[model samples]
Target: MASAETDSKSLFSLESYHVSEEHGFILPEPLEELPPYYKPWMDIALRVPELVHSHELRSHVNKMPLLSSTFLQKHRELRLAHLALSMMTMGYIWQEGEKNTAEILPQNLAVPYWEVSQRLGLPPIITHADAVLANWKKKDPDGPFNMQNLELLVRLPGGESVRGFFLVTLLVELAGVPAVRSIPTVINGVRCSDTEAVARGLEIISKSIEDMTDALRLMQVYVDPSVFYGIMRIYLSGWKDNPCMPKGLIYEGVQTEPMEYSGGSAAQSSLLHCFDELLGVKHEPKSASFLIRMRDYMPPLHKKLIQDISLQPSLRNFVQQQDCKDLNKAFDLCVTKLLALRSYHINVVSRFITVPAARARQLREQNHDSDGEIISRAPTALEERGTGGSGIMSFLKTVRDQTKDTLLPEASKEVKHHS
Candidate 1:
């Protein structure tokens, strides 16, 4: 038991880790030299926070082409990833409490964000980009990518206090790896009508989902209601004004103009979409659907590829066959695990955010001035976002509920009947 504890501690030891100056997820180049078109916005986003609300910034973003010729002319994929990361980072810091903003973001975070916002036809604002980019790091500059290290870094935020939320995030990232690895195999299997190969991919994804849920259960011990709420107050310090919980992160320039959308974050969770494609789960026709519109936020190439793969008659036929029970089971397992995680989050939000917000309101009411000039404590932006007063918790809960309804009983049952 002692040895197991030691091993676990060493696995998360930061002394063994370092930021990879080269070959890190974020490009090493300075923000000053990239995508001349986005520099103006970057300047305003980094320096003049108030300027983002003005029409000038919006006008500047409006005039830029959706896919800048410069982006198409260069390292398209890498550049797109960089831009997405930067915009998310800027949005994250822009809303962060004044105290956490002192560490001026390195160029690694600045350049690509501005460039990507131009490409995606959206203003450079805080979104799910921050959540995805927050965990990128490496033990050695030249080392291969390690998901364990990424998981460890995520736990560093609130330490033991907010370990549950960070642990869930880590498990989510870890879960996506096998899904990503199985992509090529699944695609190739469909192309060749190899049901066995497709089955193999499904097995891997199912096991990964199970593992993720198991990992999430460990969060129960680490999550103390009061402590977790306090930690969130610190983490969400920057997201007061922006209450929209982004659905996915946009990696590619797909739209001509910014549209009111969610699901950009879903793009990061590649496994969920991969399941939809393999099982022929169509969420598009449904109104206000959580996962359907996520495709709009994905890069054009990726979105197109997923669409093409889904359209393959062989894959759909295989999923519909009675012999594909194992594949169907695997798909169901993934959905169940995801729902479990969402349920866990909902409970945590209720305890940490919803309840506290209600109490804070009660306290304010009780403290009001007798003379009708109501004496009150002005809540900080972070406090407001943290306490569920900003509508973030409600938005998140609605998305989760919608997803739960959309997937369970109905979709799973349909797939089973077809099989």
Candidate 2:
């Protein structure tokens, strides 16, 4: 455990962790392509969604040549490699939707994916890091940063919704830059008893949380609920905890025993973890166990940044000891904003997962067709689980309620009264 004095004395810099002052956790200039020798990955990765739709993805992936990870030297190159391999892995595993799942990842894909994942401190399966943070490229370098100008370098099974799901998430990370930039200010202010600076930083974070929620709203405009639940989702599912692959997947060349990993999840995003640590929000055991496990999925540096922020002198403690109403109020408002953001996340889950799940149930009950269209559509195994493997509604609601628990005594009373 790091002592508070040690944490305060050491300078915590975002750049040290590859977190940008202007882009937060979004990779600054992700390479869109790899070297010529890596053509197999890019060719198959770029065509995943199309190939899957045509039912040729598994065949193409099974035929892929074994490639070595030695040539990927640069950081961005490694990221692009991971993204490409991760996409190929997903398309390969879930090519025939969720029913006819592949149990063994062929040595051609498995060997390189395991190698790159080891080097990057990410799981061999697709993660939020691969799908969102390091997956974007602008249409024009000089153009303004907006949805219209942004696009994914690689795609998954869901066409427009896949593009929308990833790009919208990238924009939200982009919108969080100012808040990330202010983290040091908040910590330094707490260290020196500078209430005004702390308050100012908290306010910026509050507004950024609001902006993130606003950006999340675009999901409605970009991702169709039925499409997300029925089509794009299964491609994101991992072997672990999924009934489709009860024993987990075998990485052929890496290990004889099967390995398990969660699929792409918002929990893998470091932004919320950083905020939760900084705001002193303590989660109950259920949410905490799952969130803690998610850190293993993040880039090591990002996981370190969240851990270091947690060890810093508690901002909540500082505010409570202060004589400044502005400081206390600022802390309260920040927590309140985070609560709203989580609430909005639940709303998103409702539209994309919950509601669609209910409709799938209705359709299944009504259509006694022998073909089982409903089971084939979204995989009955995944309707209750979140993108990762946590219990969908309960996990989110527990997390949201935990955020509410972080409010100061008086603020808790007020928020509870209103809520």
Candidate 3:
């Protein structure tokens, strides 16, 4: 039995959370007119410890073995909590009521319900972004990022109640992905429960993932694999909760077999499965978001390798034209390496070389020491041959002859055997 003073102290403890100088938006007060169903959303969030960290929720759902309706129903207790977390986020930046411009109607300046109340008039709708920019201008016309204005805006009594600016930025960043754009819309009179909104958002995002199979697979090469894994986990969790749901089924239609896992930490073990099958990895409760994780795990060299492979005709056009067998094999190896690198390309390369370490040492024992670095200088023979006065035919013949020794080693051998 806690005393009334203790309750007051606990509630007040969160007041010191800072509203950064960058946060210009403010959440409207909680809606007094909120539907009864919305009560669970708000209360469950306050009651559930797991719901507080949205990232953790994503992580936990992903690591599960089989996400099915029964599992989700068991975790149904988390639904409202999930919604509460999302609603708090939405309150900060959801483009609502606003039309072409991003302005909150002055009369409709909805404060959080817990804050001071005034029956403000319903303002005209505008594009939320435009309204936000316009409002920022009105708030601080001359200031750029409006450091001071932003600082003041954040300090506004009721608006400063949620998490820091970083979380908002992270949400905004993810919202740009095509999958998020598919978030379902459920407009019911200017006020919807946060839980409902998040569910809709999640639904759309999950559907989008299902729709963009190829693109998502391509993204595996660019984004963090771990984050991809997390996103997949969320999708799986949703799917497990609703087995009939068509979410994350995009890859199922692709004529490819799913990859199997090798081993690693519970968080990263899925790397093995993802690399084995780029777009065909089966969903594991643990590493469903392996693609996201790969994106996060990618090193700078991985990007460089992808760029080089994409640019080099051998790898780039190979997929399109289906040419040279050796080049095709090399290109496949490159893709595997790109995915397997996860966080450290150097380590992947080192591990790759180990199988032939003795051969490599023997080769090194004879050749010039070229420390794991690729050489790209122009060939001296080409420069000398160009300088010599030779007819185009003769020059070309010379080139053909030289190429035979290097690039055309197999062809040269065939020619010798024929001779």
Candidate 4:
């Protein structure tokens, strides 16, 4: 485990990045005055628009406008689920341990439920029950029923069943919100690079789990559900690093082995390779990465059908020769990578670059450097040499000048005559 001091130093000392409001990156009301942890996560939220526009991600939100009323409805529901599920797991763990801290939670920590929620947001979702009902009513005035009627028909426990109901609804919403769309922002005070921010977020999540080991065991009732929630949140926050998880989940239904980041099924391998090349993320096929993968890895048959082409020697040849088997596939991959790049560029670079001249002046004080100005002034190897040095002639000149300056007039004249 990383020491807290080291982690803190890494985060706070990181180079500061600018945040953008023009691109849906408004500082949340709850986080403006708080510590830095929220900034990284808010940065994640700010990138969702690009995700929605991505060819790879368009299917997730194609039905609605980016962050429209429908999107927000899903977002609210997912956030609610994230909080409720985490809290319920904590409660279950507390009860299972007979309220004993030793058997139910990590040492040196008291708060559990909300703390975990703070660590994981509900995997951002694309659907909401209210949205669906509203849609049904608008399209079919005599719609068969509503969520309330459906719940009654199913005979689920009064409101408790909402979790399960929401679970399915959330999955439907997920079609609109790719696992990659809901990245978890590592909340900290550090000014880190993009890679560092992701690393810190993962580290915090891992630590939070360690701290909750005892609690996790006690929360048997909530284990599977919490795992489901945790797994999704984990991927949403770091899908690029945990690509295998989503890949496995999407293709194999569960993550069983490490994914090959370089190559595999021609369609997928090519896509993953492009994603890595464009995004600089090396996805590993780890156990925790499955759920997110499952969400994206449509089965071979579906992929074939979706591409609107019958598979034969041509598809293979296309993938091998052209480097992409189908137009839709290529389009999707292009969109995904482009959106991912745009998100990073906006969240990590534009925000800082946009800092007002006044603020930049204060930050650099004597330097008076804008972010671009500093970047432009980066040194080159050849520029490192001092102007006074070249070779023997330069050295000789320096020595002569010094000797002449240090000598008395008579001594210098005598030395010159002897020479």
Which number leads on TM-score? 2
Candidate 2 backbone clash number: 0
Model 2 alpha-carbon drift over 4 Å, by segment: 1-9, 368-376
lDDT of 1 by residue, 1-419 (tens): 01222333322111221212232112222122336564544454333224333324333333433333344344434343444344434334434333333233333343345565566543343323233433344456466444333332222123455434544554555645565556556556655556677778767766766665665565556665554543334333322233432222232333333223232232334345655565554443332343444444443444455565566554445555535666556545555565565667667557655665565566566864523321112233333443312345655555455444434454656644754
lDDT of every predicted structure (CA atoms) = 0.44, 0.89, 0.25, 0.25
Instruction: Give the per-residue lDDT of model 2 (tens digit) for 102-207.
Output: 9999999999999999999889989888899999888899998899999899999777988999999888887778888899889888777778888999999999
What's the distance in Å from true for residue 26, model 2?
A: 0.4
Candidate with maximal lDDT: 2
Q: Can you give the lDDT of residue 230 in candidate 3?
A: 17
lDDT (10s digit) by residue, model 3, range 33-99: 1234344334432332333233232222223232111222211222222223323222222112111
In TM-score terms, candidate 3 sits at 0.19
Clashing residue pairs in candidate 2, if any? none
Candidate 2's TM-score: 0.96
Clashes of each: 15, 0, 52, 28
